[model samples]
Target chain A: MVVRRPGGRSARVRAAVHQAVTELVAERGYGKFTVADVAARAGVADTSVYRRWGDLEELTADVVITWLTRTSPVPDTGTLDGDLRTYAANVVREADGPAGPAVLRLVIALAAAGETGARAREQFLAERSRQLRTMLDRARARGEEAPEVADVVDQILAPVYVRSLFGMGPLTGELADDLVDRMLGTPGRGPS
Target chain B: MVVRRPGGRSARVRAAVHQAVTELVAERGYGKFTVADVAARAGVADTSVYRRWGDLEELTADVVITWLTRTSPVPDTGTLDGDLRTYAANVVREADGPAGPAVLRLVIALAAAGETGARAREQFLAERSRQLRTMLDRARARGEEAPEVADVVDQILAPVYVRSLFGMGPLTGELADDLVDRMLGTPGRGPS
Candidate 1:
């Protein structure tokens, strides 16, 4: 891992604190956690946690943002249907992989807690939206889709988040492709 | 307006309790509010708070579930595109209405907090997904869309939730309709 050294000790301290926050939240839930617990778990000074972050919410946002940055970009397949299917497949792959469910559960958990948690959820969603838009724009530019695909993209891809967050149903590769093709209205293969 | 019973004390009490939970969550946030505070705000006996719900998380879930059930259903326009546009428009209307931002903010707040909150968030999404599926299925049954439209619907509509929860952009009537047409790939004066 490339260590961030610009802020030196502060950066190191922040990393430790963030790791602790994620772990503690996972283990105890946000309502049950405290800054003191985070500080202890991180093996850092309590003053450090207080000095670095105004509160746990800000700290949580930073940690999530950093984690999100590490996620891979959506693949380019030169076709809207192919691209969306690929994207949905990636979502499923991530969900089946290690950091996926944890982060998702964390977000859902936070959202359930109420306002502060809600803000964190919104921040995370905003970041995802920006990324999705970029991917969609690229596809549109590549002539993989009509210029008007953005609206459909939102509707087509919503099930993944719904599945991930709500545990409602399976979001598999086949389902993803089916969804994409249906929304695209791919001739005989559309909808039904 | 209409009272449930003669005394209607129980209904009044529930309403008061729900209102208190919403306000406390909005104010101090879920993290800071306790059962005692919720009871005090509702002007109910503390024992009642404990008796009615096993714990604070459960109480929060009840209040949220109640609120979600009250959200109006999307209309039937006898066409998939029209239905979706109406659905999206309805969602946008609610999201922008009086209770929209606050309730949304609250759900995100709790879900972000941790496991119990995550469970609550899942329930919230479940209700929404169920309602959405019902509407979509009816449209498909009417041959407005193919049988495969379920997945298509999932894909096209997921972005709105993604944007809403994440605070990405405005999901207005015109924008929603545009999205509906794009995902459905229908030609018209929809999104370019």
Candidate 2:
């Protein structure tokens, strides 16, 4: 068995294929294109794509995982409030970015797809949960009060994502701060 | 213009066509079928669908509006807490229902399709906001404090929709109540 070197030809091909997949998904939406389309768009051999990814679903999942991993690095501010604000801001920025809508569409499509898509969605969410836990755990260790992982998901992440998904309005930094403030019960706005 | 009676053949045909559109969207996930397909499934003439909706996007928008109007009625339980709880519970129920996923998928598809889809998404969202405003206005008129419609959208509606979209877990009435409690800062878990 041959081992592939990191940051080599394999990496380049993978990046090219993933970019192609994202463009296709954004332009045509899910299931409208195929592995061959990706191959052609990437200027690679169709056999290579087939051999590497096995199917369109697997390839799409890999694209999602890769995209998410590259984009969202959890913030590590010293205070829980700072950390959460930064985290929420990062989320808003990403969701409003160029690739945001495509990735959002991809995630929803994967979740709605059958078993394989469900597994991909699970892996994506589990990774997100793990990231949040790391931030919250760090906050708790420093004797800072932190909301539960689920609370963060519901209050911060979910709302940002839903807003992006539905195009409710511009996802502003102020909105992120407000969410954190509300969750932490800081002196922002009282329950009216 | 020919006069069409309410609750007659016109209504029956509309119901059939709408049901057919929902089923198709549920089964195929959008952009897979055509007017002929819808007409065949709906047991109505293709021309009738064309004359009524003009295109799939218009038909889809109507479907979304019809579904949302039928499913969610603003709840009034004489208190802000009770009203929010019941409203959130109703949302959870609808999102967890048989047609929930279909509608969710359709909305996303519409939003991503183009200008037409964007308009549909806006219409759907505006109607939801109207419903929330009606509830909040009533509460305010009764001298009860009420959250802004945007807050409810972000805190309650967004989380539920995002959860349902991602298949995070079972959306329950308790969860709905918890959301309301968190929003209102009632006698529940403190900020932590």
Candidate 3:
């Protein structure tokens, strides 16, 4: 294999800075985190961090986007129901996992305030929605009839956010199955 | 009409305080605004506001509940699909209007943080869910078949919150129609 060198060091530095940012946001929330703090935690030079990211918001945009993008996988279970269950369960699992809802709320609140993080938030959702389209297209080929892919995707995923936010109910894998079944109109299908 | 006396004055004070809280939360957000600030803006005595509200969180809980309760009317449109269209469109319109997604994000963030406002957030969502139950119950009485009201309600309303928080596409009326149609399995129903 060819050895990669030129972009390696810079990529590693970016990774370190991002790790520091993620830890800080998860620990203390993103509102007051500073570039200097990230540099210290990352064990990189503050000047280098600043030079690469420009500022805290730019650093923050990347942190939010990376977390959201990697948290859910684009499942290819070969059918819409299977793919959607995987997809919905992934959304619930992400909501339940370590990053936690507080950080999520902070991101949404910032976007709602029309902050610079809006682009990051928008990019995050768009990527997820793209995966959903792929899943729906596969479903349609299998003779499923939901032409409104985005709308159906939102119905499957939004309940997780709503219930999570309201502290209303547990986000279980079963709930994910129920959601997909309801949307697809295939209730009581045996687990496949 | 029943003539109200002592309770009327107290109700008026509470309403004014809640109005001020809603405005302040919408204007400067939830973290910084105080009881004294609300009292000052509401033209009520600081002592009166403090004694009544106890803290910002109590006032905030009431504000969120009141706005959510009043924003939508339970539909009786003679068909489950029709009622759902009115219901889903109302959820979208509320997100698009004043007392908007920012306030919602703030409330959810507060609740997720395990603040006192968690009770308020819980109360607000419960009220909205209750309304959905009424509409769905009416549909059931008219011989519709979806018995899982809570599940179906979440399917319809949760997407509005998810899309709003993520700063996704506009919560358009057409999107609302698409959501109701997909959920209800009626593709080409005209307004009835």
lDDT per residue for candidate 1 within B1-192, as digits (tens), equals 864667589888889999998888766766678889999989999999899887787788788777755764656787867667676676666665666656755665665566867777766666666777777788768866532434433544456555555455676777666556555654221122
Candidate 2 — which residues are off by over 4 angstroms?
Answer: A1-6, A31-59, A186-192, B1-6, B27-40, B45-47, B50-56, B186-192
Which digits, one per residue and each the tens of the lDDT, describe model 3 over residues B94-166?
8877667856776675666566566667666677668778877787788786435665556566777777777
> By TM-score, is 2 or 3 better?
2
Which candidate leads the pack in TM-score?
A: 2
Candidate 1: where are CA atoms >4 Å away?
A: A1-66, A76-84, A95-98, A101-157, A183-192, B1-7, B27-37, B46-61, B74-86, B105-157, B182-192
The lowest-lDDT stretch of 10 consecutive residues in candidate 3 chain B is B183-192
Question: Tens digit of lDDT per residue, candidate 1, span A71-166?
Answer: 645667877666667776776666645576567656655655678787777776667667777777887688665423344335444566655544
Model 1: per-residue Cα lDDT at residue A179: 53
lDDT measured at residue B62 in model 2 versus the true structure, 0 to 100: 86
Ranking by TM-score: 2, 3, 1
Give a tens-digit lDDT track for model 2, residues B1-192: 987677689889999999998889877757778989999998988999999999877788889988887787788888877888888898899988877867877887777666857877887888778888999999999988777888888778888888888888789998888778777862222253
Candidate 2, residue A20: CA error in Å? Answer: 2.7
True-vs-predicted CA distance for residue A140, candidate 1, Å? 6.6
Fnat of each prediction? 0.29, 0.41, 0.43
lDDT for A76 (candidate 1) = 73
